[model samples]
Target: MRKRDLEIIKHLEMFRVMSRDDIVDLHFKHLKNPIGNANTVLKRLVRDGQIEVSTMHSPYLYFPVGNHIKKNSTKIPHYLKLVQVYKDLCEIEPPTEFIIEPQYKKGLAEPDIYCVFKGTPLFIEVQNSIYSSKQMEDKIKRYELLKQSELVKPFPTIIMITNTRYAIESDQIKVIQTPSIAHLIHKANEDSNTPPPPQPIKTNGNITFKL
Candidate 1:
């Protein structure tokens, strides 16, 4: 797949699952380059089975090849930014799923980027600020509480992607990765046996303010 293609899918997979509006929102995120390409790529991925496509017509439903979406502590618009980053990374491997809005009552409240790498649930947060420390810690605690669920996994990481640093509760259980958008896009893919195609040279979007 092209780097852009992988990136788009990476973003698509971030939702618990997505509807048509979600896709349109993403179209602005990564597919402003041209027309028709988004639909074409979606069809191809569905045929390849790397992604799941649900035909709801008025609101198309799409998901990664998984049965369910995971947990996160972000809203949809906010999470889309993080998802874009993950998509760039998926030029090689699928980013583990993350839910920005943790569902509760259904009992999900640790809304960070949670992943099971090597059998551990690593919860990551890309923080641009420390003003929300206490509330963020509460989310971590909720993660621990929710880990008791047979459906929930344990082990978490709360990454803060920031320009400045601040203290966080050490007792709640978390780890931090400092701000690094290691655009290793070319690097990560090159490391893989399969390298993603080079991004097409372009300059049109530089003159615009995208949503």
Candidate 2:
């Protein structure tokens, strides 16, 4: 198999679910006809039993072959949102490392994404639904426990992506609440008096902001 094909499969396995357009943007955008090329390649993969496709959704969602996740799993949307966040960060500066739904020892914090971007370690919590005050507090407490564990040297900052703003304060670790990663990055550049990065190369299937 080709290297790109393997990479695509690995991504599907790692991310749990990805849309057709997500695959195209990440791997085929450099080509002359990205979507066309993606469709052709994806069809072959599906035929070869390398990946599974769900036609229920427009543009279709792809999963690793033999994946346990149900085609109609409710977590599919959440995973897709996480993928978009990763893509946005890649447009600015590709993260050195990005892990989806990284797990920790029992009682430790579980973040939707754990990535190293521009030399900073970050733990991202993507809140699709409004979390109760108690739930939020418990999450913060778990993070606090994680910090105390010192499992990760030079603990990472926690970023909460949600529509509703919550007053999150902690002395152990920095917690940032933002509607989206783009807004957070833009604000960071402004604070440091640095110009925002150039516009993303692929605008389709992505949420674009002026930054």
User: For candidate 2, lDDT tens digit of each residue in 148-195?
Assistant: 988877889888999998877677889989999999888977889977
Cα-based lDDT for every prediction: 0.55, 0.91
Candidate 2 stretches greater than 4 Å from native: 194-211
RMSD of 1: 15.5
Q: Tell me, by TM-score, which candidate is best.
A: 2
**Runs in model 1 with CA error above 4 Å?**
1-36, 39-77, 96-100, 104-109, 117-120, 128-133, 136-140, 147-151, 180-211
* lDDT tens digits by residue: candidate 1, 69-92: 332223433454465544444444
- Which candidate ranks first by lDDT, i.e. highest? 2
